[model samples]
Target: MAEDRILVTGADGFIGSHLTETLVRQGAKVRAFCLYNSFGTRGHLDRLDPEVQAKIEFFTGDIRDSGSARAAVQGCDTVLHLAALIAIPYSYAAPESYVDTNVKGTLNLLSAAKELGVKKFVHTSTSEVYGTAQYVPIDEKHPLNAQSPYAATKVGADQMAIAFQRSFGLAVAVIRPFNTFGPRQSARAVLPTIITQIASGKNEIRLGNLKATRDFCYVKDTVAGFIAVMRSEQAVGEVTNIGSDFEVSIGDAADIIAELMGRKISIRVDEERLRPDASEVERLWAATDKAKALTDWRPQYAGREGFQRGLTETIAWFKDPRNLAGYDPSRYQV
Candidate 1:
């Protein structure tokens, strides 16, 4: 038997970069498929340790291109597809792009993976796919109601992944994570938006839908869940959610973050930051039982205490002057 060689699409993005580094450190051969850009920017993957970065086989190409997709997947045993346009506000502006990248790009990868006989294909999904949870602890069976174009594209991509598995017997495991937060997160995300504003010495921060609730999982926990799903044969053709069982409203979360940072901060709703009335996902709470039963994956950061611990670490990372320099806290990030 040959060792499993992995190809991680979107290796330049936040979570993908971390996963790439972890796989390299674990002595796995990884081909990192980063988006090609004129400036040669590798996104967050450039931040990895010199030695770790050196060990990765870098393939700079666009996931939207089928030729490039197959080239990256060639000789790889596992495909961790994470490339997609993920900003909700922007998705509202350009939905066609989401379909091209999220749905079509996934098709290209699935086609390539099947053609090459890849052993496993781990597809990424989001809690946004479930909309404003009609029931508490939304499980794999929860009805999907995409509240935004971004979520809609994810749903499309997820369905395509499952379809490939069912139609061709291509190994696929869909990992749906709810509100993962930690270091290296872009400022566009709610947690990063709040933390960056506070770090930049703002007493008042602009926000939207603070009452919306979320089950926030730490990045490490979420990444571990993905690995567990990849290792489990039973997870093939299944969807598992990675999240903290606990939930908190965005407003209360801000208060907790403020307390953790020792900063007294106030949040004011920025009209521009608010999503359209019907598009806002007001609540999300993940039922982690499926992930546990299928992959033996448990979120180390669960509940209010875990949330606080995760925030403390995240705050410290953002407080570092070097890390904070990458973001402009004054600008409203979409």
Candidate 2:
């Protein structure tokens, strides 16, 4: 058979960049879509090894514009949509922006995919859509309660994608990943936030609510899940969760990373960092049985291993004078 032509939107970000690299390694002709910036920055994709960078076709554009989205999707067999404003704290400050970028942007992509007759559209989702996890292991059918503006927009985006698949036969699949963490992750994410601070020689780590528990998956494993979903016919028009079944509280996670680093640090809760009580998803744990059955995808990295790997890689990156220059650990990132 012919090799798949793949377009990965948000290829500039953490997981997207890794996914783009993986596709290229697997012999896919990849067009990497990164958000346009005045600096002509490619984000993490720019940091990828030169060999991988050479294999990718780069396009700078905004997902909010249908013309741009359609242009990017054209001539591609599969479209992996991962672009969005993902910071929960920032979403609270500018909700309309999230709705525009996440919801409307998704609408534009789905419409373009439908028009372009793409073979498959993998829609990325987050476990936050199932707020607080009323059930132990959140299944696909779990009720979606958007606790934060970010989660609300993602919920809107996922529903819109599925609607197009069912109503217009767009061949869309929703892949919900829970807390993917790794080297390229933004410091705004909890894992990177804590690791960066401690690695910066800080004796005290400032954080938000530490009681909330989360199910984290390594970035590579999460990317693998995406590939599995794309290859599986059974995943079409279906929602599959990519996550480690294990759960850990923020406090415990911080301690684990600190212990791994051989550092004894005091963790202080920053008021500005805490989410509103009602808006906070107290707990999130995912059920991957459907994914295992449909895509035969299972998380290869457990909590401790995943956490250590992410912490080790992230710490090494942040320790680099160049990478550290990009991050301000003392400042509370949105």
Best candidate (score: lDDT): 1
Count: clashes, candidate 2:
0
lDDT of 2: 0.90
Per-residue lDDT of candidate 2, residues 1-334 (tens digit): 1387888998999999999999898888999999999999998998988999998999999999999999999888899999999999999889999999999999988888899899999999999999998988889999999999999999999999999989999899999999988877888899889888987899999999999999978887899999999989999999999888788899999998888788999999999999888999999988999999998687878656765776677677767888877888999988
What does candidate 2 score on TM?
0.97
Against the reference, the lDDT scores of all candidates come to: 0.93, 0.90
Task: Give per-residue lDDT, candidate 1, residue 236.
Answer: 94
Q: Write the per-residue lDDT of candidate 1 for residues 220-257, one digit (tens) a residue.
A: 89888878998999999999999998999999999999
Report clash pairs, candidate 1.
none
